[model samples]
Target chain A: MSDTRIIKKRYIFMASVFIGLALLLVILPEKSTSKQLKPEQLLLQINDNNRYVSTDEDARKIIAGDNYMQLIDVRSPGEYVEFHLKGAINIPIDSIFNKDKNGDYVYEDILNQDVKINVFYSNGTVYANQVWILLKRLNYKNNYVMKGGLNRWIETVIRPPKPSVTATVNEVALYNFRKAASMYFGGGSVAVPAEDNAPAPIIKKKPKQEEEGGC
Target chain B: MEEVKIQQNTPRKYMNPYLAGVLLGLVILFSFYLTREGLGASGAFKRGVAKVEQIIIPAHVNSEKSAFYHYVKNGEDPLKNRLVYMIIGVFIGGFLSGAINHRLKLKLEHSPKITSKTRAIAAVIGGAIFGIGSAFGRGCTSGAGLDGMAVLATSGFVVVGMIFGVGYLVAWFFRKLWI
Candidate 1:
């Protein structure tokens, strides 16, 4: 064949491959089919109504009680080791949809169609929210994210006296709120008398000093 | 005879834009299928910055004060990541494709209407802005925007629209940067 004809044939082949790829991208379903939520929509949802919990009242119950829900820590492995909810299993966010030895994600082992799975994060709830969205896309029902993440937990729950050198006062305030909120839910301290009539159930934690406590 | 000689000297043409775009989409899909992740570009840049910060301000980079310090302090080899490898693959792929199509050249690409200096300056400025924006938006064209969208991330579309909108809205003022 002439050089011009050879070039024309190559062009045709490349064009066909390109077209095929475009079609594939068009057809793939990366997100869920249910009413999709935009970042703006999610933000609006949080602001308009606190439909999402930073950490639910039942968190302590789950962590301590006999019949407990599985706690999945989606943060990095190191973060998981540094400090995480007691009894929570570490499944790094990166490894969530990742394949294993058989080249399949471990999602099936942790959950089935009926189970309720809760996720939380360190700072503002972006990563956990992302995972929540992913689970929704995968058609998993009853999956929820602990809003405000660990940041909210540290801010509201932990209330460790401000680490003077590292963070600012405002940062400390936020950290206190997050820390307090986490322990409020994770600690199972609902028995404290409510000062407000709104009746928000307070979480109570077993004293850390108490020896032989449940893991 | 002159026409034949002219054809012999001219470099091979670039792949059609539509074709290139489609191939890029497939590359993204293939990445998702194999690794359950999408293609990323700015992350590689961030890692590059992290490596630099490690050398210059080791303490600050390792401290909680800096946003990037957390990953480094985790004992995670920031470079030993799938995205980093994928980015290297992207460079190799782009260069190889360019070579096979005979479009490879050492010079910078710019519009005919702009001066080389202006183009170069714009490239640098654009790159820097892109670097910062990607960090905030959580990725750039390839990373957050495209990959996020392919995975059906709502934020992906938001960032993509914002980036393009901002680019177009400001493009008029920077007309001198490009034709």
Candidate 2:
């Protein structure tokens, strides 16, 4: 074939490929059929809405016998077996979408439930946050993340700290609430020493050094 | 025969770079508006790799431990991914552009100073390094540099700066290949 003819053939081939791809894009099923939230809108929701539950708030809800609230432990099965919040159901993050012998999603029934609230917690906020986002994308309603996850739960509930004497009224009140929550959860709480009334020391951070130029 | 000769000899001029850039920006904006995400190039490569891995070791591709498994686990065709489709469109658009400009000749592009073999070797090395870098960076130039910069992301600025800085720094050593 001549040079121009070959070029024309190549151009026609490319055009055909382009048309084929465009058709495929239009015909193929989407990854998700549900109306999914945009990343920007998701970010806005995360920042604007109260998506996190404080350890105190979680403890209060659990202790108050709130049947409408569901606590989902999103950690590994081994981690969940070791110790988890009372009345919390273990749903390892990996197996959230496992298929049963009947070819139905294992958590389909649970996820489809019309619960008032479903609080997901993991070792930290990362895993829970991931699960939350996934559930949100699936159009699951009333999903929340346990702020700071089990780490914060251990710090605030398992070891309630006593406020210093010089602490503000709000700080002291919050400490008291935490103490009460600790007692309800059967966690140990230390008494505030009268002699230890000094204000907490404020440490000044060193200035960050400028980054070196060039990669 | 005379008309054919005239047509073959006449090559159209290329579009202005500024206009091309503006058009590219608009395309990126429209992509973001439609999909809630910007354009990406390396993701198509990753999906391609995952598809290849799946074909080679089906069990390994389905294993929970495999990082690539997620791409194919949803029963979705890897080639059908949005990025893969975008890449196909890119190839087609590039070829069409070259054809329109009468610049679609099949030949290796290299400076006269370097042999085609040397250029080929350099290209392979450069592509391999770029693939690894893109994997680490979580994106390629089109995805991270252009799309991220279009959104005014901090990482975008940093990556683009690093790319040009490193390119300039190493250009002198490989001056013979191009200059």
Candidate 3:
């Protein structure tokens, strides 16, 4: 009879604990959770004051006229310097969640922004989407992620000509620039014409006659 | 006899629920402070599922149109991700707490009103539904809803409300399963 009573008491205690956990989950506020937005839903959430444009074309339009939209390149610092969209700021994906030396989340640099729209881009969707989710969790409702990343931009925006298994001088220069920029930035480089207006011309000269070899 | 051992084994007392909750909350805060993100569970499960799918149905894995599958394909080993690492931390945290409280055991907990078989079946069914719901909702209780709420996100609140609201609404029909 005593054992039975003890078992009954234990059961109640466990049940209450589980219920409390479940209740806690239910009651947690929306500020800390990742917002799982479908592509369409996220797009719809973007208003004129908070547009979430993905493509270079839209980015160009926004830069040309709309001063309110803030374009963010969520690639590496090196990638941003190479070739980013026009008027985009570079903030690496790793740095998106960076902590200080004391292991505290750097608050002021990340959350204090009073911007109209915050759009993020990366080499592809993964990093950008991660940033999008992070910002949404931080109560930054006016956030957007660029679709397809800079790879898509190179395909659809830059539209480089198909090479017949050989590189032209211009193509080589572009490729080298991209490689260097990616190294410098992190992944795909951002190339805003206003900032990186001139493609550094490759100075190619015929090799000097090998007089030393002849001698 | 084993059942007797389990019953006689003097179960450990657990931490006060409120204190445990506050500890969990601080863990979450520390995680965000260090990584600028919250804790997660379902992401690991999804990655595990994707890996299994990759092994059993390679063609289907290759053919999926979703970006998530693309990520799996692009040599980004899902198991090595931050979420996976965090889940490892969670297991350690949970086990440590359990061990400290003398709750480490492989026993099936159930209500007095249900048979062990019935409880097992309910557990499986509940898990399946929870898995599907997590996919649609983009995360589970810990990841999307609880952590999302801490940061004050609207979507977090919406999902938490919807999931619990549905759970309560249907709980009446499933009373036998729990009670």
Top model by DockQ, which number? 2
Tens digit per residue, CA lDDT, model 1, A1-215: 69889989988998788789889989987774455456675565445433255553434444355233555668887766666664456667777887778965566445333433444454567777777666654545445566677665544454434556778888776556545554654443433332322321222332223111000
Q: Looking at model 3, give its docking quality level.
A: incorrect
Question: How does chain B score by TM in each prediction?
Answer: 0.87, 0.89, 0.86
**Candidate 2 stretches greater than 4 Å from native:** A1-215, B1-6, B63-67, B74-76
**After best superposition, candidate 3 residue B61: deviation in angstroms?**
2.1
Query: Which of the predicted structures, 2 or 3, would earn the higher TM-score when compared with the native?
Result: 2
Q: B114, model 3: CA deviation in Å?
A: 1.8
Residue A123 Cα positional deviation in candidate 3, in Å, after optimal superposition? 34
Candidate 2's residue-wise lDDT over B1-179, tens digit each? 75675488665666756558768889989988998678888888888887888888878878887666667776756677688888888899989988766777879999999899999999999999998888666688888888878888887888889899999999999999998
Candidate 3 chain A: worst-modelled 10 consecutive residues by lDDT: A206-215
The DockQ of each candidate is 0.01, 0.02, 0.01
What tens-digit string does per-residue lDDT give for candidate 1 at B79-174? Answer: 766667877888998899776655677898888988788888888987887777777776778777888778788888898899899889988997
lDDT of 1 at A105: 55
Supply fnat for every model shown.
0.00, 0.00, 0.00
- For candidate 2, the docking band is incorrect
